[model samples]
Target: MRYNRNEAFRFAFKEPLHARFSIYEVNGKEVETTEGEIQLMDLSPSGAKTYTELNIPYTANNSVKITIHFQLNESTYNFKGKIVWKKVWSDGFMYGVSFLVNEDMQQEIVKQLKIHVKSLKN
Candidate 1:
């Protein structure tokens, strides 16, 4: 499928997530870190678009550790993500992150999102 670069998608709910990205570059020899709160806008199989206070300048394939929080089954869930995409915004940087090494957590997220989407449909 082809996508237009200037398309708008609305989010069902703005989930709050906070994470610290340990950015590595220069062949794993240089590192920098930034902490910020992200407002997850929308999610797709490709990635998620999030708004953050820290504007991290990164290229494609840059690795980052994102610590995020979500609510599932009436409990808060926290997990880390690997940065996949980064873009600059007026407020800050928007990043696309892929969840790392947590199948259960990912399941819980999917469950919550499914429940939310289902409610919207009804």
Candidate 2:
């Protein structure tokens, strides 16, 4: 089934930002955690594409119950998502993460992204 395409707008930051992520099960079981410096390549309300270097390989459609922690404006934010697509490179992997979030969380993400973008403009 084809998912609706969401326009992905890229954001540029003056300094680098890293997203620390942990992949686990929906039942709250721990799987693995890794810290990777990530570039927010593009974003939409429902999903985001990130560029990072991962030591492990993740398959497409792999239900990635992940907790992504990152700092924005000196405040830390945590988001959860599932891996919809994965591309393996010689060094690491790139993932297209579809957020497993409710309406409120979705709104929060959008708001935070907007804020982050605005901060970069200043």
TM-score, each model? 0.59, 0.69
**Model 1 ranges off by over 4 Å:** 1-35, 44-47, 118-122
- Taken over the whole model, the C-alpha lDDT of each candidate is 0.56, 0.63
The residue-by-residue lDDT of candidate 2 on 4-84, one tens digit each, is 444334443444466777776533456766555665555556766676776434554344566677766666767778777
Clashing pairs in 2: none
Winner by TM-score: 2
- The prediction achieving the highest lDDT against the true structure is 2
Candidate 1, backbone clash total: 0
- lDDT, candidate 1, 1-122, per-residue tens: 12335422223345443333444443345555554456766643324567777766557654555556654335565555567787788868778766564556555556666666676578
